[model samples]
Target chain A: MYIILFVKISDVGENTLIEIIQDLISSSESRPDFRRKENLILGIGDDAAVWKTESGLEISTTDTMVQGVHFSFAYSSWYDIGWRAMASNLSDIAAMGGAPLYALINIGLPIDTDVDNVKDLYKGILAVGDKYSVRIVGGDLVKSHIIFITIVIIGASSQNLMLRSEMKSGDVIAVTGSLGSSAAGLRVLSGALTNNSEMHKSIIDTHLRPTPRIIEGQILAENGIRAAMDISDGLVIDLNRLCNSSGVGAIIHTDKIPTDRRLKSDFSGEEILGWALSGGEDYELLFSGPESIVLSVIPMMPAGATIIGEVSGFNVGRVSVLDPENKPIKLNDKGWDHFKL
Target chain B: MYIILFVKISDVGENTLIEIIQDLISSSESRPDFRRKENLILGIGDDAAVWKTESGLEISTTDTMVQGVHFSFAYSSWYDIGWRAMASNLSDIAAMGGAPLYALINIGLPIDTDVDNVKDLYKGILAVGDKYSVRIVGGDLVKSHIIFITIVIIGASSQNLMLRSEMKSGDVIAVTGSLGSSAAGLRVLSGALTNNSEMHKSIIDTHLRPTPRIIEGQILAENGIRAAMDISDGLVIDLNRLCNSSGVGAIIHTDKIPTDRRLKSDFSGEEILGWALSGGEDYELLFSGPESIVLSVIPMMPAGATIIGEVSGFNVGRVSVLDPENKPIKLNDKGWDHFKL
Candidate 1:
């Protein structure tokens, strides 16, 4: 008899798992099917998969949200859950500067789940779909012990594609809308803070129902902005990913980070700053371009765009945050990792 | 204080749930985005969602499989689970006479799952992907209490499309390959039946790794056969669905059902017939067309197609199975339903 050993996902972490997957895919490159197709513009390592279509390019993306891990029903209604789920996928397409065309939803729920709740979930999904002209084509519903929703969105775009690997040294980095409110909203929902003000209610709504920046992303793409990504995993972490992909570094000023003024009225500066830095789920668009082009397109943005930093060549893949005094600030948390120990 | 009551999914049943969904989608028809899209050929109620492309048609479908609900690790390896999940989506595309092009795999696993197991799962997915020249484009990995996999597949087909609503009276119903082995193999794995013969191993393999009838579906489509669907639910139940879609009915002879010779040697006639009628997960293509066209295409099928029944005008949306002596046999069980009380 022989003994067997096992290695858990937490032991190697999410990054290593991704690396292993890449390696497996690369190793199969010799196979005819795995060979790179001419029409496939991008695959595996991007916000959305891209391929050439008749007139332009087709974009596809998928996102999965698990109950308890992603959201809690104690604070989020079924409609909110559905809206958030569809929003996440729509945001991915927005990050790529693509307009969503169709979506297929896959839901797994317990048999005893309320029928009205499930219908409300679809209502929320349709609400977002209608806003962006995305059609709900088909889906699969299965029985499960825990609840989960997975949405697959297909979209279209012109030749102008926003990509993370296109960031260049000396390009200015900017973000649309505000951040930290969604994370702060979670703090309120978790009962870490107590507030019943109208401002607090708005913050909670921001967390529950996010609007993907479709028009803003299109404006940037149409105006020649090439390097961009959505701020899903916080500014510092996602900026680091963009830098790593582009083989560069960045220096963002904390004072220049755009955040909700209403959040400042309720939370401490330190608490708000921390949330803004590493608080995930803020579906704002973070993009980089030349200073002249970036400044030219700012006025066209609906939610307003702010220049937060500039890309650099030194300390590749690292993001340095500076205070108003221009001194580097150290961060305690790295962003969200599904398999982090 | 205010009180609210909830109606559980089991309260209305799966059919009612689907009808409710249809009502919701139809009610939103006034919205500009919800209006009929010119390029969309088929929308909600089918094996796959279809839309027109420049040269042909594009097909998409999604399926979700939850651990314990769909499969258990006690008998199945992670590799088998991945293969089955991908196979389900592939079979959906095949049912439409489409050739799969790309796939996005979304996996939700417990944090403590073994890393090697996940790799084996990908290996299994890639094995099937490589067989059909399907490229694995992108996916999302999330944390969950229960392991689940959702795969979204995109495929393409020529103008000739096989649809469920195209069945006509006097059409001969035929199916590719044998059935009942998969359900029988599940019993062997569940320990309800004990067997150690070589044929038992083959039966177990059949249950573990099912091959979708892609070539057979395409041949039927190219040869002018129009109505078809995969035998995922039982033959009787799936046939009923075909009839419902076409506004017709069917009568299938139980004696004509093709079964594995090895399954017949080990299991009773009643047990084998029950599995064939409603065991589901067979992944065989059940199709109907003119008798001459169906017989003409039989020579092209790799697995040898068998004529099992014929479509009729009576008993719309109903399926009747007749015995060898011409007596009607009553079925105690319908096909698989996620929410059946």
Candidate 2:
């Protein structure tokens, strides 16, 4: 077989992610052939690049969205794809309590792509940029077999940045909005929409118009709630990650969990429970903080938020699904894994 | 007749660049789909995102080098491609006088790709990263039709970051190294390499390994350089942009221009002059400073460096070339364009 390796020579899609990433990390960065600059404060580390900011503290992050794997323009509008790219990366900044400022988009379009389609994609990107007051300054456009958008967002922060590994024992766990709407939305868009049409409307919207919890992030940081991350890959899986990173465990209460009405009925309490655990695209914040801070912020969640669990010390990472009597039940680890999927 | 407006879609056969970056970026951080944190100083922009140093001042930038467009893996080894990507983006950060610290990479792989090929490519990326003391902390990987490597670099700066739009009138102009070698290399690699094997070594190296001007950026920033940028895009285009942005004009001495030896016999001084003005990938520093500062730095540069030009007040926004007798000589723009060859 004349197969090319990590440089993308697949006739069909490939699935060797970890192996490929390892190779990329193993490469060199030196080149004596060219003159180099020395002002780069940080070239390639951390959640977002930390650069020198003359005005506000600038935190930068880049996200790449590709067709087929990420979304299908077949069912999703060109505008939706564009908006999704900006919104998702924007959330990363918001998670760190930064104000969005500028964005650059590097896009690859297939030759068959229509000009209107390209413009529509930009329209969506610009819409999101306009919403956040982020300017689209520069980017690259190229030809490719598929359509891809690489977005870079630069924002400002004054407070200390939040990291995933800061959750402590006795901290309350909460999430903004409801869970499973987006994961369910994906099902519908993928032509597997199981819920009724009305339910599908809300579900699809949840998936298509995911709202980054920027305000919630600011409030949490302001109130001294430090440990947090967006729950895109199942709440359970993400909570497990946050807990593990912080060296803690979580006890999730079945009744206290938030579920969109679409999920509340179409899926059983247990299935919904499972979905809540394994469903990706929740787009809700799963955060842990001191009880006092939670109390002060309870009234501030505009659409109502849920305190689903608490952080506690555990030898091995574990999630407790409690009954009314608070007994533990086994929850399946069914969250999205790009590799296995 | 529908046609893509960009180039670099051909095959040089090292690794094909895939377009999976689409969903990856949109799904990361936060969006309507996930919870977000709020302390992020920057999400993404410029060479890298800027963040309030968890401790000190820092800056960062990222560039994605796709196969075919950035390098031809056939003539240039995988190691060279990795070296160039690192040098290219780091050059941007270094241009601002930031200290290099970390480098992160996201690699896209094709499933059938060979293990050895992946190893060589990464070794190149690593060689450069380690030389600069930049650690590779995190990255992502996925299957793609072609190979695309996106590199993020973090840097540190104690001084104000450099801006390209800050040049002034009467500032002396200078370049750190010779120009046209890269394009000359391109000429050879693009089937122009006949029997002139001995003469084309520099041309080959110039194309495969244009260095990032890290030291020059620091020196200039430290020495009070308000406006500076590396010569990636051609000199005429880039300089035109600089002068236009700073609201000034510029003049260059044709005899003072530095170039590869190959060009001397093939073209007239004026023709070669045009190449110096436009043929890019020189990876040199084209910077402007006060007359005194420019003269002072002349002694500091190796003989390779030259004072080929100076900022002018003769016109509000134009670049004029002066021949040996100091008379203006009109020349056609000969630099590379993205859409053009």
Candidate 3:
């Protein structure tokens, strides 16, 4: 909290990359969070991690976070990079309604990289790991240009793992937090909202430290929710991915899209709706189930899950957004892409 | 075979390091290696790997290979990188008398890395994985100035994992294969021996892709061999490590160090013995057992295991070499390190 942690991708100096990295990750290895299971035999110091899996089903997922491509070094810290890297993968497992167990990280540092940067990045990685009770096992260290991170997460599903294709026409759609804030945060970072101090902190925080919706994922899945996924590629695109994968369609109301505390309509509801629809980087789980089950879980929304849309098979893949006048407006599909560079 | 397949720590480039890393690992989400067992699934993919273990001991080790520092980039190709990566880890598993079940790889790629280099690296990785029946379950990739690789192997042992320290002063010493070929290959690569055109192919082959003695490790373990380790940091340094680890001493005969058929030397047997003792990268397994059980496996060594020394309790940390008339001579500690850059 004392220091704002953001590194500009463009300015990632190679001269001290390694030492910085070593320093960044050192803290994470030293201290762990509460959610770590007991049998994490070897965390960060060995050739590979050793684990003991109990009876539940083990699920695994890997994701890469690249500088400039995946995130802007503009106002991001090594910790931000580390946090989002693991958060993204954990989000995937959460969407499937699983309890995360372990993670292995690989870091590429540029020459002249300071060992401290490595430790800082790892500090973020370990903070997340500890929060989830996932132990930092074993990993490798090497140097490279433009920092690249790949995170693999292993989790356990108490129930059958949820798949995106299992949703039916009548399921109700819900999300584990508000959207558009992260995109707003990015805009502020790019200097579009350069002077708005209040809006800046709220939005920037959303972008810099997005948390995975692991808890809500469990609530929904344990209660029979079968189709879900993390919303990384704008809500509109992600909803379509889920519906299409499940052979269903959906109709979402723009008026119902959630918002942060300060958005008093400087932009049209439609524009804000579009941000929620096409903007990405919100590691929130989006799930759908029966209307009755959704209502029953509303009061118990696990610190985040907010109802955002409804599942109507008639609108599969083509998400229809109704404005205040209940009129359908066209939305664009723009999400993050590694190839953008 | 014209090019050895591995990126030495010396020849690391700067480029799309992460993409090339994709082919090296298997889809952990695909499924478990077999029917699920009740154990702690500690770590997966992230910054550090984590897991929990109960009623089990932890074993740890690390190794590093550089371009000119540890290998010549000219003869070493990506395949060699991949194979040696797996082979080196598997050798460690064998030394512990454990069957390798899982492996995690960490790779460093420079920005200029090509698709083929990446794929070829994975092919080598996968080939070795298949050979050892190891599931290339998880790993990470990054860009770096030097192409450095670190592989962490995890395996299970039904009995006490073998240690180098268990050898007593009277225990017999043995090696699994001939030495100096890898070193000779390095010598050839350095332009020290250009005229041996007839032996070029064989020597290079010997140096480029040396297989680890896992089967022999099994033989040693099943037949009750106690102290063991792979001869990677040279027989001299590695033997010193084992002795130091087990709090024991050792002495070896000069004429006993294994040598290839094409090898020729004018120096006394003790000098040739020096190269065999301290020249690293031999990758053969060094082990000790009761002289009686050692006799049973004598004929079983296809590459042949030679008795070189006996463990000495009072001299636990000392590695002494005897000349033709049993005269002692000073030796060099020729092991590899990354900072050699």
Could you give candidate 3's per-residue lDDT for residues B103-215 as a string of tens digits? Answer: 55556555555545666676676566555665444444544445666565555554544666577778888888888777766667667665766566666666666777767
Residues A33-83, model 3: lDDT tens digits: 312234443332211233444544555566656576566677788878887
C-alpha RMSD for every candidate: 1.7, 7.6, 12.9
Error of 3 at A26 (Å): 38
TM-score of chain B of 2: 0.79
List the per-model TM-score of the A chain. 0.97, 0.83, 0.80
Model 1 error, position B296 (Å): 1.0
Between candidates 1 and 3, the one scoring higher on DockQ is: 1
TM-score of each: 0.97, 0.76, 0.71
In candidate 1, what are the lDDT values of residues A121-169, reduced to their tens digit?
9999888878876777888889999999999999888789999999999
**Better candidate number, 1 or 2, judged by TM-score:** 1
Every model: iRMSD: 1.7, 9.4, 16.3
Kindly provide the TM-score of model 3 when superposed on the true structure, using C-alpha atoms.
0.71
- Candidate 2 chain A lowest-lDDT run of ten: A6-15
Highest TM-score model number: 1
Give DockQ per model, in order.
Answer: 0.70, 0.13, 0.07
Q: Candidate 1, B276: how far from true, in Å?
A: 0.9
Q: Write the per-residue lDDT of candidate 1 for residues B1-341, one digit (tens) a residue.
A: 88888899977777788888878876765665454567888888889999986767999999999998898999999999988888888999888888888899999988999999999999888787777878888999999989999999998886789999999998999999998888988888888767588888887877888898888888888889889999888788888899999999999999999999778788899999999999989899999999999999999999888999999989888888999997999887546786876
